[model samples]
Target: EIIAAIEGLMKDPAVGHPLKGKRVLVTSGPTREPIDPVRYISNHSSGKQGHAIAKAAAEAGAEVTLVTGPVSLADPVGVTVVHVESARDMLAAVEAALPADIAVFAAAVADWRVASVADNKLKKGAGGPPSLAFVENPDILATIAKHGSKRPQLVVGFAAETEAVVDNARAKLARKGCDLIVANDVAPGTGTFGGDANTVHLVTPDSVETWDRQSKDGVARALVTRLAEMIAKA
Candidate 1:
């Protein structure tokens, strides 16, 4: 209902289209890295938070482009959706949707991919356990945040951590060259992987804002408003 709220705000005389002319790009879900014809590597992200953010941005009157990975969620209304499968595909899609005013890298992209994928599923015979080699995937956030010409004015990234949440996020904010980092604890039993609610800490260069636990939609709405205000000040 966060997007619906934006519609409500639009009708109010006091609130206009704050992000009307802005271009927003959001990345969501988890990319799959192929291991074999029948197998792949992926994560447990449900795309709930990212989708909500995209919807919120669209509702706020921004021209939104959502680059997403495999998920079961429906596409957010009034937004352009680009579906991709792997980290490479996601990076390509993000690069194509360039010069965004705001970019949110919410996707839990794989850190590594299989070096060589099998053409066919390997049979479990006398070969025992097969050795699989891996290589690092492209750092999408870093690439976009460090872009020279096509860089978005504001770039955001997410840190799903089980320990040292704020510290790790702070490090990531600098390491990835992003303006903001949304950090959350995804330790087992947190119900963060597929749950609707989120407890997040927004880490920036100046300070950190820890928001109370709330639905993903609530967080999205608040974040969108905060970002719009920041852009306005800039």
Candidate 2:
């Protein structure tokens, strides 16, 4: 059955996984930054791409560890999933499952979290709304990319931007210190958020390669295949 599945996947070119003996780590979904016990801030990440990558990695015969934020999807088969809510929690989870061959950061983590969260929900005052302060969240991709010894052989980050998609992605690639950045525009009404399809540009220090529009699963397979080749050459 497994051989049949692999042969079927190989025929597609975009859906074959060849990552045997590799250890892959993936982060997915939207991280919620809590403001109070009842309120929080988050984005609209659905985790489709990240989850698909994890599934593809497992299919490629890799041992996968998926560190994900809050989402409503079932866990992928043959992947070890670690559930987390906040950006801090996600970072801690990723750190705990380190020494991986590859790391993919696909989570739309909140850039800032409330400086101080109230123990209870803040009540609406008669005078005005409650004021909230924010602080920067941990830079998980950059952190792992810059790790001294425990760093993965390949570190990939996702950049969801509205303007200057490729340029911004290139900037993020340099800024995050990751090996590659998978960038896509998530402008309103683009269907990139919570959508199955994607148009991505693989940004690396050497070049930016744009891919044709395709399903997230196809993208995952192609990416895994590329990473496997790179690891083999390394």
Off by over 4 Å in 1: 1-16
Off by over 4 Å in 2: 1-17
RMSD of each: 4.2, 4.1
Global lDDT of each candidate: 0.94, 0.93
The alpha-carbon deviation from the true structure for residue 85 of candidate 2, after best TM-score superposition, in angstroms, is: 0.2
Indicate the residue-level lDDT of 135 in model 1.
100
Question: lDDT winner among the candidates?
Answer: 1
Residue-by-residue lDDT tens digits, candidate 1, 33-79: 99999999999999999999999998888999999999999999999
**RMSD from true fold, candidate 2:** 4.1
TM-score list, all predictions: 0.94, 0.92
